[model samples]
Target: MSYPFGCIVVGSGHAGCCAALSAVEAGCQRVLVVEKGPKEWAGGNGYFTAGAHRTVHGGLRDLLPIVQNVTPAAVATIDMEPYSSEAFTTDIMRLGGGKSDPEMVSAVVGGSRDAVKWLAEWVHVPFILSFNRQAYLVNGRQKFWGGMVLSVEGGGKGLIAAHQQALEREGVDVWYETPAVELILEDGHVTGVVVLRNGQRIWLRASAVILACGGFESSPELRAKHLGSDWSRAKVRGTPYNTGDGLLLAQFAGAQLTGDFAHCHSTCWDANAPDDRGDRELSNQFTKSGYPLGLMLNAQGHRFVDEGEDFRNYTYAKFGREILHQPGGYAFQVWDSQTIKWLREEEYGDDVVKKIWANDVAQLADNLISEGLEDREAFINTIAAYNAAVQASQRERREVRWDPAIKDGLSTQSSQQFLALPKSNWALTLEQQPFLAVKVACGITFTFGGLAIDPETAGVISASSGEPIPGLFCAGELTGGIFFGNYPGGSGLTAGAVFGRKAGREAAKLAEDIYN
Candidate 1:
């Protein structure tokens, strides 16, 4: 059966759902969403997140409306810092190495709060303060830091459910297991989509089409081609369905591909994770991000990157690539009793494998050798040197400044004398008993490269003309130029919502003008 529509959105992830809903609201009577995966796996990478969203907010009061957990009593005990548009813009530009499109960055940062508010007010999605990940207790007061303040109730899966509910409420029809194979371009503009649904190919005509499918993070071939030869060794953190379908579809329709092809959003994940894209049960548990509190060593028992280079959020994305580039694509995050509690709750889960523990550092070193630690003495000596530096820093009165809420100056000095890679902050003495080490591998979230689009309208830009295609558009990870080498925490969801809404609305207007 063939059904013509005014607007057709490929991929039912956060971006596609938002686009479909916004298109219906913008007077597109027959807006439809086509997802490659089944209904159970609908949300894409957004489903695997902690659901944190970075936005410009006045403070706790401004967030109270959307955050269900915030109460008057809870507000007084926490320091909810305001994240302004300027700060958001700065973080995006700085983390992206100033390589991101300034106009898209401005649109994302300026519209972040409104996007979150739209999710709550218009889309009816519920959010709450991300207390577990973004806050720390100081003198009996919980202080929120790191610029992230809110998350959907059950995290990313909850967010997808919310979007599904909103789509159902708005009467937006969604076709599961329907993959858009190609875009039908006519007169130099996108006019329809050829989709593979239920073992049959159908050409669905539309006035406008929005490519919100996602990036090429799950494609091993593409990863090896663009993200270096070692990239295929990295674990896929999200949906395997996102294999560059959107990028290929858009490029075939004359869209300009932009952004950093060699870089992607990655993190330290469990080395034992399956080769395919991980599921919801594993969720964010694949991450082992407590390295700032301790240390990360390669297979040789030698540290490779600076573990405490910055807050985990600021550095986790890039460090995973470092791990992948390491010999055998493996690393271990080691911690002691002193910093064990500082680890995220995900680390202790049953899903994590190759967790080694011992009463002291020497036993820990011996146990690690079986797991591919080539040099036992080198590992022990490295720990000893790191401990000595921590003790020296403690003697210098840096102990009083030892606070985890912010970057305390608790760093190492002598470790630099003995080791190539040294801890830069939170260099606590690993002198405590029962040292713990967990196996880690590189987990790629999404690629930072895709089709370029206009920031104002979310319309795909033609490579030849350098102008927007009449009815072609994109959002989410499919639209590049907003992120490059690195990404700010929680900005992915915000970008999807902001640009998704814009693409949907613009596509609807185009459909009304051209097809009506």
Candidate 2:
């Protein structure tokens, strides 16, 4: 039998794009990419991301070569700290609660820098230093924080466009509206894929198959089945087409599932966003990440999470569950004029969401009642008590040095006495006039569990024999054992590229070995 293609890639997200290109570079002459969505919905969940990628770097000098937007003057004004491979691994493990696989974490960390460089040079992705999102002008210098400092010029849209251009240049065939229905197995080894195209089931033979489709976050049924019933109601923050096709296909081929199925990468999103789908235009703008700069309170006028706990990306993923667990499945983020101007315009601009403003504490609480504050008295009392605690903490600290780029020791509770829950970082008292607030709800990004794969080759592991399913590779969100309960921000895309590159190169080798 003559095989039509050397390798077939399922899914057309960033991971799949990376895999396809790698396969082509590895000598795969006939490679095809299958995308479940139509041409308009091509990039999968990656289309709705902020396009930030986390990678290890030797400070600014090392990163200057890959980034396209930074100038020499801007570089002198920027003060970025070096992120070591050890630091990256420790951060991932810490955020995952020490449940992340050491091997996978090591692979991602070791490969991240090169993966980012390849994306910038090979794919021509418009890379920029994350000055607006990650840095603050502290002491007349741009200080980048949280160990993440790179993003696409136009976020996900720009990233997808760059990948598309690269694919076109490489002469790869991308079939939109073609969904992979099942894996074609021969003697317990995947040989091809059965796809539904033009309302017909067509079998395409290939030497190797790589699955890079995303997780099951878009499927309410899978969310309820694997992540819990409450997740069924959570708003999807990305493409609605990611219904776990690759995950299901791998399972049907006897792939073993690993990682935490009950958890996901969720965030505080706009409470008013559409429940089932995400806006292609607004995209991640619905995310309410400014909670770290202010206070997040439930309907009953109580602080449920430490808004100042760690950096926003480090804690934002898990905070969505905290908001979902609150009464009525929603919460409100409040900030006074003291911190309102500092909120990121990309997320909290006037046209993005309805912003309620008030002049005083009582008026703010009264206005919030219309927005969902349960008790006016409780809201006022909570603000008063929080203000008092902030004053107390300031007095004990003796010096007030508030820096957004660093864990500015400024806090709301101190030695003499502290609240049951303390704001551990930038804790300016929210007493300034004209307070602002916005309603927020949980926005599910992607699930935490998927098919177990070899960290080196991205080959899916078989459930029956604890061995790789030959010629069946996996990447992206479908490949699990990387993340657990929580994930560090920007790590997902980097991990996807790292493993996708591996899967592509290995699949090309396997195909050459079989067909050449």
Candidate 3:
């Protein structure tokens, strides 16, 4: 069947869903969302997300002083800490290596609160306020896809189900398992798409086409081509459907890709294993198990970054960036039993002990030995040395020598707090009964760089001339450099909502102006 849509949105992931919904809401009469996978199947990197959307608005100023004054007492609530807009922007820009587009960054940072409000208030999606009840965090509040499966309820099949329902209500048609193979262009204008479905090729016409199919994380060939040998063998933690289909199609149509050098959650699972469940089990284990945050080390056993820092910040540091270039693109999470126990207890609760393979030092050593991931003697010595420093620091009433990194930054009160904790490096002590070591590899969720677009309209720009590609729009992961290089906590979903709405609304308006 030759299906004609006023606007065709490719890929049914977060960006695609948001784009379609926003397009219909913007008054597009006949909209179509082309999904390459089945409705029940997970699409894009949205499913693997922890669902924390970071914004700088809200009562950030009021909460910053509280966080700064009480962070030591509230370290357990790091996930819930409220950051000011200035702090968030500063950290993001610093993390981006000063390469982020200021205009786009401002839009994303500025629109964050509104996006969160829309998701919570307008979409009726439930979100958890941080442990301190100051900011919002998404933790199992709804299914990964906002609980839209076969029904309108939030607990439905997946996000696509909910997005699809919203689209249908607004008169949008959805073609599942219908992959767009090629773009149909006429007179230097994008007019329609050639889609493959049911073992047959079909033509779907649209006034405008928006490519939101995501990045090339799952495509080894593309990774080799862009990311080089370092990431050639890296495993993916997101959806398998992100094979760069949209990217390839856009490139074929003369679109330029950016941020080929950027990726999300660089340290993930090793995908070389035959039975890789996309690292879901490992991620759950890491999140649920309360492994004390410390520095990661390479096979040669050297500290990379202050593991206590945020994961995203740690990944962009010089050492973490260099580790990605090393063999296996892997590192180890080294911590002691106490931290592990605390983490498991706090994050996973009673289920923490059950999920972890090793409980104490000996069991952990034995477990590492079985996995062939670490040497028992070296691991033991490392812990002993760390513990010795902890004891010495307590007696001396000074910071420990083992961790020079933390000492320089400690204030008087910070030093006192450090001394209070059994004179031990609570964040990185190896003195506990059972030493635990987990083999961690840089698992990239999706590439951050893709075709550049106007931040306001989500219109793809020409690579050579730096002009908008008329009749062509991009959203979600397909639009690169939106976050610059550093990803704000909740910016992924916020970007989808902000830019997706912008793109869809503008695309519909353009379509109506031309074809009405």
Candidate 4:
């Protein structure tokens, strides 16, 4: 079977939607976006996000265009620090362990603010302050922490909906339940894609093809093959449709794969959450990210990773992998009544959640005795020591004020007194009873590994040859080298918009040059 379009984009997530919309803006009359998932589940992992986009902003004035309901008085009460392009790029390079491609990092970081502006001004995607994840209250005034500030009004679903509306407004054709299976190359250049649509194999010929599909985190076989055998137990946090189709398709096109294949963007999710993606009611509840406010203990009642090493946005992605490495692939996020108000409402209010609480740390340990908890004495002693250390650290730093908006330098000082892993920041005393615990497990978001593409144009480059594949572009999670094991929160959405728009415009130009 055969069909024709001016430009064809694989997948219908944020990347594909942006690619299709931009293609139309670049003079493509007929742009087709193909997705394997059904209409309700078309947006891929992007629809499952918090709608946050990490971008470089020059304080309150720079963010005013996107952030809704921002008054001069409200802005005056908050501290809006500038996140510069250099700082953005440096953060990526640093967090990625210096393995991020400098060129790709530069392109994404340099274009992020403009890309976000485009989304708000041109696409009309409503943006709001990320009060839950990126900001903290200090002195009765809201202060933004981390480099991120804005998110779509309704998060991932809202972001996808806005992009979908824009695509529809541009008259871009969308083919749902059509999964791109193969790339047809002629004279070493991409000409079209072969996809499965309605149980029929159809060859959709186009002047250009943009692969905006995702990575292979959903496939256990691929996870074991690339990310090590331990990833086999990793529960998927998004759609089950992202089974490495895009990565495999790009690889078959001779694209060089890069980034940390053995690592992914993972997080602590409800341990009893479904193996597949959660529904709208669950939303981002699959996440249990407020661990920094309290404690995380393994089955043996021991702290492993540094919960307060940094902000949750900076550390949440990699911590799930650590939880998966623990015995029985489970950990519990423990907190007290005093810090419970700070927990993200999405997580604490989850219907599937089972809260375990007790009056004391020892009683809390006993509550989990039936769930393979062993060391009651150790658990009691650990909390007692942690509490004492917090009191001591507060006294030692008597001149230093405690602030939740930033790293207050208030840490548990007893880690040196014992051999347990230390809480490096925001270590408040867990003495305020009753104690609480929420069982959590590893939930994988997306794989960090993908094909390499041209930094400026988002054109896929051939591995065998050091040249771009003509009429071939790539973006979103399918493009590699920008992220390693760790990524700054909200940057994924920004990357999708920046590179997806670039790929669309470049592919449209290529199509015009060839077929016009």
Candidate with the greatest lDDT versus the true structure: 2
Worst lDDT run of 10 residues, candidate 3, spans 143-152
TM-score of each: 0.97, 0.98, 0.78, 0.97
List the candidate 3 regions with Cα displacement exceeding 4 Å. Answer: 60-82, 130-165, 260-264, 268-302, 310-331, 344-363, 391-428, 483-486
The per-prediction CA RMSD against the true structure, in angstroms, equals: 1.7, 1.2, 7.4, 1.6
Error of 3 at 107 (Å): 2.1
lDDT (0-100) at residue 89 of candidate 2? 96
Model 4 TM-score is 0.97
lDDT score at residue 182, model 4, on the 0-100 scale: 94
- Compared with the true structure, all predictions reach lDDT values of 0.85, 0.90, 0.57, 0.85
* Candidate 2 C-alpha lDDT tens digits along 1-516: 334788999999999999999999899879999999999998988888889999999999999998888887887888999999999999999988899989999999999999999998888999899887888887899999999999999999999999999999999999999999999999998999999889988899998899998999999999999988888889999988889888889989999999988899999999999998889899989999998789988999989998888988899999998898888889999999988888999999999999988999899888989888897898888878888898999999977688888898788888875789889999889988889999999999998899899998899999999999998998888878888888899999999999999999998898789776
lDDT (0-100) at residue 139 of candidate 2?
Answer: 84
- Order the candidates by lDDT, highest first — what do you get? 2, 1, 4, 3
Assess candidate 2 and give its lDDT. 0.90
Q: For residues 51-148, could you state the per-residue lDDT of candidate 3 as single tens digits?
A: 44566543423333212133444434333224456766675677677777777677777776666565554444445433311221234221111110
**Segments in model 2 whose C-alpha atoms lie over 4 Å from true places:** 1-3
lDDT of 1 by residue, 349-452 (tens): 54455679999888988898888788788888878887777677567664457677777767775433424566777778887888899988999998998888
Error of 2 at 394 (Å): 0.6
Tally clashing residue pairs in candidate 1: 0
Candidate 1 deviant stretches above 4 angstroms: 350-354, 414-420
